[model samples]
Target: MKATIRWAGDVKFEAESGSGHTVTIDGPPDHGGKNQGVRPMELMLLGVGGCSSFDVMHILKKSRQDVTGCVAEVEAERVDEVPAVFKSIHLHFIVTGRALKEAQVKRAVELSAEKYCSASIMLGKAGVDITHSYEIHEAAE
Candidate 1:
């Protein structure tokens, strides 16, 4: 569970994970960055989204739900003061499958937010207002 970030110049960095994954991070031009890649805060939000989405899909699979596709759309707000931090975060999951049970979808989302997703739990403990919701769409035969 480790990563390294190297300064690439002008508010830009190369981030490498312990698992051999890499990403480029940079700020916008207004912040002295070239806008070369995703902002660091944006990456954090994405990490949270990916973490919770993984949990949701796993839970649904374990419950024998016929899930075919899933996407999590995350939105967050940050404080305007110095040392700005996330004030609120919302995750909207759109899950697609054939005859997906509404109860199953609801339960999976609840389980991820309340139990399985470590990222969400960590943010929750840090006083971030994390909320979850979902929509289930049946695939056409």
Candidate 2:
């Protein structure tokens, strides 16, 4: 529930979480960075993906779906104005399982988007166009 960001050098930082996890953040070299770590913006988007993915996996498991793998591909667009905040985001989830039920997958995604994923809800409240879709793939034998 808490984190701290410390400046490592020009355009670079080390962010530590309350759970004793650390992540290196940096910008591109053109912005006085060494490109040694993930950009802060990228991390934010990835957090959204992570949050939603966790919800989807948990839901599927609880539903007794034979889930084998799940991948979330996130895409976004930012305005050209200063600050360049995200304008829209689309999350495409590829879910793999043995005889995965489409309805179950759809329901899980809907639940995450509408109720569970806090990151997506926050971004949507900030006027970001958030959308999601999923494709279920049959697990190999």
Candidate 3:
């Protein structure tokens, strides 16, 4: 519910969450950063991906799906003018499992986007054109 961002010099910062987790954030060299860590915007996108992926995996596991691996690829567009912000974002989930049910996969994705994944919901409410799609890969029997 709370976090802190402390400057670590030259456009770099250390962000810590209330739960004691921390991550480094920095800008590109052109913006005076040393490129030591992920960009702020990149972190935002990553957060959303992580959030949704977590939900999907949890839901699938609860359904007794033999989940093997999962990956989320996210793409976003930003405004061209000053104070640039994300205008749209798309998430593609690639889920791998043994005999994974297509309907279950679809339902998991839907549950995350519509019921869970607070990050995506918040961004969507902010007018970001957030969209989701998914592919399911069955593992070799």
- Which should have the higher TM-score, number 1 or number 2? 2
Candidate 2 — which pairs collide? none
Native-to-model Cα distance after best TM-score fit, residue 30 in candidate 2, in Å: 0.6
Q: Which stretches of candidate 3 lie over 4 Å from their true place?
A: none
Flag the better candidate by TM-score, 1 or 3.
1
Q: What does the lDDT read for residue 63 in candidate 3?
A: 98
In angstroms, the error of model 3 at 94 is 0.6
The runs of at least 3 residues in candidate 2 whose Cα sits more than 4 Å from the true structure, single-residue gaps closed, are: none
Candidate 2 minimal-lDDT segment of 10 residues:
39-48
Each model's lDDT: 0.94, 0.97, 0.95
Tell me the lDDT of model 2 at 18: 97
lDDT of 1 at 79: 95
| Winner on lDDT (2 vs 3) | 2
Candidate 3: residue 31 lDDT (0-100): 93
What is the per-residue lDDT of model 2 for residues 72-111, given as tens digits with 9 covering 90 to 100?
9999999999999999999999999998899999999999
Q: Cα lDDT for residue 53, model 3? A: 96
